[model samples]
Target: MKNAKPDLVYFSGFYSEATPFIKQLRAEMKDVKFLAGDGVKNDEFIKGAGADAEGAYLSLPSPVYTGEAYKTFGDLFEKETGIKRDASPFVAEAYDAATVIIRALEKVAQEKDGKLVIDLKKLNEEIRKTELDGASGKIKFDARGENVGGETPVSLFQVKNGAFEQLKQ
Candidate 1:
């Protein structure tokens, strides 16, 4: 790599393998830029990579919430769970997913012999048609069941001083 030094080195794997590989790369090539996906955007990765994790770029394929709706959800989440909402980057997204499921269930659930019965096919269809402004931002599924209503598909983050900070778009 010294002979053909690239400007950047991108790793597409989990922290378990990426930590060691990136540490080695950082040790050998301090001048090159390092980038990875959400899999390595956690405290574990930073701890594993040590100082080598600094200045590394990470991408999260989910929305970053900062609006009032999110703030309200965060407050309630902290109160109910006794854990800060920001503790996990995916909490808002998970909450939005659960909200979507519950809404779908409400739409498709039926009463049969005093018992709730939900048709799996109808529930799936209702879920696919979901459109809601959730804690993580807009939630809408495309034809392929991929959320396409988010402000952006991927939020860029940089590891600075052993902490992941989301970069503004």
Candidate 2:
């Protein structure tokens, strides 16, 4: 890195590994700009990287949440976990995933031999047929089971003053 100095460095991994790697990069190439994916968009990375995290850029596949329900959820989440909502946007996504599963289970699961049972095939079919207005956005899966609902604009953010700030692209 010292001999062949690159102007920009892009990371494709999670924060646990990124924190140390970024620290080393900052030490070696202080001027080089660092960029990473949504995997490193959490407060843990900022906390771990400290001041070195400043000026680093990150991207998320989904746009920053704008729904009113999500705003309430974010507030409650901050109050309960003491972590800012922007630091971890995956919370709503995870909730939506769990909700999909619970809804499917409610529709397909039945009592069998004094124990709850669910056919895997039926459950998969039900999950595939899901369509709900989730906290993140409209939840609908394509034929291949990929989420086909809502616009997936790639959201860009920068680490500044110990927080992730959304950057207008």
Candidate 3:
């Protein structure tokens, strides 16, 4: 809880959605986790972008995240662009939008007609209490109006006869 004067905190993200809160957290000397990728085959791209590899592959899912049992994503990438990539990260992130909507819906439910009014404090509070399970995994809100998936079960794809299919949970 950033506002409640917690002792320690951490943040992990890749894009601008993470910027505003991290900037505020830094002001209070909070601990924000910076996750950099390593083990990426494209070292040249990382170097060109002024980034260092932290044992992660940028712009794609890691083998562990993707479950590494499917080849469709890899095959599709090759078919489209003559390059292969892991799709776990991108595919799993579909819940990003769903979580956003679910949280908003939860708040709007407070009104009889499910219409929401723009109140920053109420939005933040309602969001913090949400614990909806999403397609990617569990999307629980934290103190800072951010949905967090802390060690939730991620989706896994299975490969059969050189094809990848989404596995039912």
Candidate 4:
């Protein structure tokens, strides 16, 4: 297996990543920086998070957002030498997933029949064809929403004296 001395102890397959690691991490009482929803496939690890840890995982309909809308998101970035971008199909898919569902609901609600009649086949088609404008711009769904997005590199940079200054992105 892995013989490397890792500075970062990443639990990739959170669902299958096992609970022992989570228990150990919790018992250790150190701050456990988690990316559980960022494509961690281990079911056990994901299941281990507390009910209050809902926001800790990344999945469709994650309710995480900045309290101040339209404000710069620079302060939420990691300032290490490395930069993380999330243009993954997973995120885009999630956005698309949300959009399609919303559109389907809207479509179903508009019918004059009054009673809501949700068509799963039509819903699936709409979900497949979702083109939505979400918090992260346009999102299009493909093949059951397994797609994701890469980080935006923290934007909204500042200009300094006729020059450009890089902010968080």
Best prediction by TM-score: 2
Considering TM-score, where higher is better, how would the candidates rank from best to worst? 2, 1, 4, 3
In candidate 1, list every pair of residues with a backbone clash: none
Candidate 3, position 24, lDDT: 51
Residue pairs clashing, model 3: 37-54, 37-56, 38-54, 38-55, 38-56
Give the lDDT ranking, best first: 2, 1, 3, 4
Model 1 over residues 1-169: C-alpha lDDT tens digits?
7567999988998888989988889778987999888777767788888998899998877666777778999999999988868654588888889999999999899999999998999998998899988899988898778988766668788888888888954
Local distance difference test scores for all models: 0.84, 0.88, 0.43, 0.42
- State model 1's lDDT: 0.84
Clashes of 4: 29
What stretches of model 4 exceed 4 Å from their correct place?
A: 1-9, 12-96, 109-114, 143-169
lDDT of 1 at 157: 86
Q: Which candidate tops lDDT?
A: 2
Candidate 4 whole-model C-alpha lDDT, 0 to 1: 0.42
Which lDDT tens digits does candidate 4 get at residues 86-136?
322244335445656887777654454676677777777766666644545
Q: Write the per-residue lDDT of candidate 3 for residues 96-119, one digit (tens) a residue.
A: 455566667666555436764566
TM-score of each: 0.75, 0.91, 0.33, 0.36
lDDT (0-100) at residue 80 of candidate 2? 96
Candidate 2, residue 155: Cα displacement in angstroms equals 1.4
